[model samples]
Target: MSEEKAVEENPVTDAEATPVPEAPRPPLARRLLRSRTVRAATAAALAGALLGAGTVAWRTDTLPLAGSSAPCWDSLGSGSMDALFGDRRTEVDEQSLHDDPMGGTGAYGQCRITSYEGDRARRQVTVNVRRLDGLRGTDAQDWPREFLSSGMVSLGDGLPGMASSSRAWIALPQACTGRDDFTGPTVVDIGMGRADFEVSPDEAPRDRTALTGALIDAANGVIDGFGCSGTYREPRDLHPPVLWDSTRTSMFCGIKGLALPAAYRKELRETRASGEGGPAQVCEAGYDSDETAVRLTTVTDPALSEIYSSDALHSGAPVKGTRGYGKIGGNRAVFKALCQTGPVMFVLEQLRPAGKGSRFTFTRDLLPAYVAAEAERIGCGPQKLTLPAP
Candidate 1:
């Protein structure tokens, strides 16, 4: 996972001065993999922003990801691995999350990035575990082959591990986790590379393998700490205590049919993500099907477990769920569902096509059904909770 930036990046523009919205950025997975260029650009951007604003910056050691509710890589911390460069290493921590619902295999994972500066070599490594989810059939046996195709490696004896001369990655099996809420098959990406992007034939092989072993060991240490590897997966709930917000979006469409939906599958048009909000109360919604205008949105808020209650209503029973209400009609349905205590909510909707006789009428229980079904699907179930209709 060498992030080398070869392209000449454009000059920076003052986002604060711009009144109009900036152009949409590329998908995170593609951008993150662009290597050093992205990092340099990001640093430059931050520097420019600070300088232009005449602000002083303070560099802190062991920074916990600020303003983020996402999990930390503390489990895979420095102590997890034996020293690679003796006392010559300086470890910085980074924790990030990414999800690519439409990126073929549907990837979403948390990562920890660290760089070691030594007189011998300056190297950076990132360890990530991304779940392929419903896109891959729920079979443990086929995960190795499926993960490798995604450029992730399989490690351990029966465990899948991958490593190139400069990088190493693997897939952690869900079978090892006792959490039923961890409903999908997951893959891990553990890659390390020389900071300067230089590798020698003899040096590369030995270094890469050593890095690979270290990463695998670190990942295993993480699993050992939690007693389960999949616990890091988002949206997992224990006994419906709290929902962490559903991170997997590709699996939810207008619904499906017997492992596959024939009629609905043919109506697929496009899937686009839309939202511009801060992390505390962020919102990301997308269209799963354009033909029927099927769409979904997962809501996550810091006060979720304590203060979230979709305030949605249903036919006085408050069960079927709330509709995106007036957003769409005439040909289909639109509604919202409050899944659990984490206050994870889903806004599932379907719009009718504008046509001569198109009429939208769905079961009143559709949204509520979605709530119950998805809850069951992700192992969040049996709480029998619903948002109070306001």
Candidate 2:
């Protein structure tokens, strides 16, 4: 009892007594939590960085985060896609347009859009932007068959373009390309085909009117991309597709006075001609639905006539007339004549090899008549062509 009383009286110093209850310390986890202000600042910084990256990606066309970029360098817009491709999703691959340095090829590039239905490919649309290389022999002979065919109609509104169910083309303005000073015409052409099988014009998925709009829109885009000023107007008066009709007129291919030769009359059953007024025109007649037996074509656009310049200079015997110069041979003839508009190309060709019994000769019998008739129609008349003596 005495010892306890003594210890209590001494009463451990205030600092040692009950250790001051350690001031009721908080839990370790609670102390480690950051303040609300700090958390908000960090979240804001992360969001800003993501947004910045997205903007860059969208502009550069490097990310699909914003969905497929306007196909074909943004030349193929939403409206065109809807009209041409319908509801199908499409994929695009392009080789950016580049001008040739040596000036032989001119500006050239291509874009392809492939539409898919589920996992299978359904359709393909090819867009080519290039100078029609008449000198180098690229697209000179084959281009007319598809782009300048009877099925095609003029783009109207004074545009130098044409459209069909499966094809369309437009020439870029001379003001933009200095084309008046250049050798070849820079052009944009589109062709469509069924990805899985062959398709007839009757079964074509697109129509001429829809295709015309797509063509004009794409041309406008190309103009803008080239840093050119002005845009083309969309036409409302597009003509209906040209149909193949039985050859009832004496004038083959709808040429007013050009007669269908007896050699072709018995065998060739049908004839087709391009739209009445345009930069180019074609008349074709064939049997068994082969429209290439005899082809007579005229290219009135001065820029487009370049396609035959080299051939006119190098191909057959020299053909000189008051109008122009070119070559005349057995099966093919190419003439480049000066016109009020510019140089024009008059072509007569027999697409197939002549049979042993064949009597009609295209270059000898048809070219002179064809050129004279076509020249007059285009208002470059009084063009008399003298056939070279055999």
Candidate 3:
């Protein structure tokens, strides 16, 4: 059988003979080119080897790679704010300015943009921020009266960093040193540098617009770069020594530490007096209705105890318990209550039906309550609340 098959295959023509089979596998070069993992690994190995040999690959940067140099840590300095001065083209001579732009400061830092070569005239901007020491609210107050025309700028809420700038007159030598008498607790004060002698005295300099603008810009830049958020606006509960010391405030009101009736609100005007009698705080009412108008005043009447005494009640202001009740006399139906607490006094007067006035009108309410209430509010202890006798 094998002889017959060989004889048949030999007789077959080369075309009819099955074509010799090619190699079972691809060539070494083809095999290598077809493999993705092998190609990538080989390329990486070649690159590392070249780098080790101090030879860089051509168009290496064009190749998409991950590793690169990182940035340096940012520096902090209140003086060298050159990077913040985007408007400053060329650096000129600089001088340190020292002045409390806002009055009553614990500490202050100031820097100036002495000179810069810009499209406009040689302008300068000074950025000054005075800390309030152990306080917080002054930083967010409106700009000083000097910059009254200038508006307020806020970096939104939560960021205490805010700024204000104005194009104000720099009167040659008079204001050459900037304002030295300004007062307040301002956190960020950015204004044009007044040291520049080339300024008009009568009117604001025309080129100073840029200087003022630069101050505002630089101030914001510093706040952003230095992470100065939540540092400017402080809404504090500033109260006078006595609530009545303020003519208009939460502490001073028509009723004893309480708001007046809406009808008498419009007429609630405060009047205060301090003299030989003592210090008295008062709130007088004004109304248009036929209803009675009340007048609440604080008097330093020296004879307060004597006048409010039962003996003096028949003649002058009368006293009953902690209050003195009486009429305003004549056809006017107004009654007055006097509460003298040591040296301080608060008087409450209520309007009544004409000719029918009674001192008990204010007795129902504790007119003298605030004498103790205010003392307590101020964290005072054991005040002489008992009324003094004649």
Candidate 4:
């Protein structure tokens, strides 16, 4: 009574009262851990450290958690990517393909992939699936220069495509999209971004096997994705890489009968001619500062022919004696006709105009010869074109 009464009245405040009553005892595991030998503790700690190391490896991709995955909607597999971009880590950004059947817009999609070495971007690739449009946008002007350059060789074996180290492209099969007499053809094209840009038009390095294989794989995947009816067979007979050749007055850009003007004939020049017996043929010739002073092109693919529709119909003087119509200007001439294979376009452009007064004469003479020879080669011969008087 005396002790209890004294404690209650004083309400012990110094150094905590009664050492908090010796708190509840921990379970057996805690007791064992507290009493364990140094060796046992070290073994447990080592096991924990190993487990954590494994977790770090998995998180850092040093160890695979499961299977590897492809990017760009699985269109490009890891093997293809590795071939294209060595051993760099790659990241892809894409826009889903859209098809508007009722709208007649066809299908369009795009994917861009950037490869990284550590924190820096090393290379980039861009893939596009869309219809060629000459009427609207810059596709008509820009596409031909990039995709139809002479550096590319035909994707032979009846496949409507071409490939090189820097670029590759394939047209969709006609059976799937039906023949659109009015619009351009749909195509899948891939380019190696700045690598393609850095290449010289005169001489470009080629990786035909890797580039063509990747192109076909990408195209086939697109066809499946678009639910197309047929597939393009692998091109076993791809032609040799297109190379630049020295030009002469008698044969310019490999057109047997075509000749360069007397002024241009004297200058040292080179030419690049490509896409024989296929969708398109391009002949480019120039000297010194001008890589393409004279460009003569023939478009047999009906879809590609539409690229010149506007210029053929509206600009310059009218063309005569053809199943179709077009115009001839001082520096440029565009003509379209209905061949057995559908519509075809013949074009002759002089990037540098002829000597003062002879621009009109230059266009007139060159356009006809280009058309006649190209038409004969492509099985659309016996065709004639004439510009209006004056």
Q: Is candidate 2 or candidate 3 better by TM-score?
A: 2
RMSD of 1: 19.2
lDDT tens readout by residue for model 3, 168-270? 2110111111222212223444565432223343323333333333333333322322222211112111111111222343344432354333332344344
| Order of quality (TM-score) | 2, 4, 1, 3
lDDT of 3 at 132: 30
Candidate 1 per-residue lDDT over residues 62-125, each given as its tens digit: 3333432212233333433433333444444443223333333223434444445644445555
Off by over 4 Å in 3: 1-88, 92-106, 118-121, 131-143, 146-150, 164-186, 193-390
Per-candidate Cα lDDT values, in order, are: 0.34, 0.64, 0.29, 0.62
Listed in order, each prediction's TM-score against the native is: 0.31, 0.77, 0.23, 0.74
Clashes of each: 21, 0, 12, 0
CA lDDT for candidate 1: 0.34
Best by TM-score: 2
Which tens-of-lDDT digit does each residue in 1-390 have in candidate 2?
A: 112222332222213321111123322112111212112223444355422232111111222323334666566666777777788877766544444433542345677777788888887788887777666656677787678766666776577778777788988776554453336677888888721122566655345555666676667666655555566666647776566678754777888777766656665667777757778887766664543577777888787778777788877888776688888877889988798888889988887643337644756777777778888878888788876777
lDDT of 1 at 378: 40
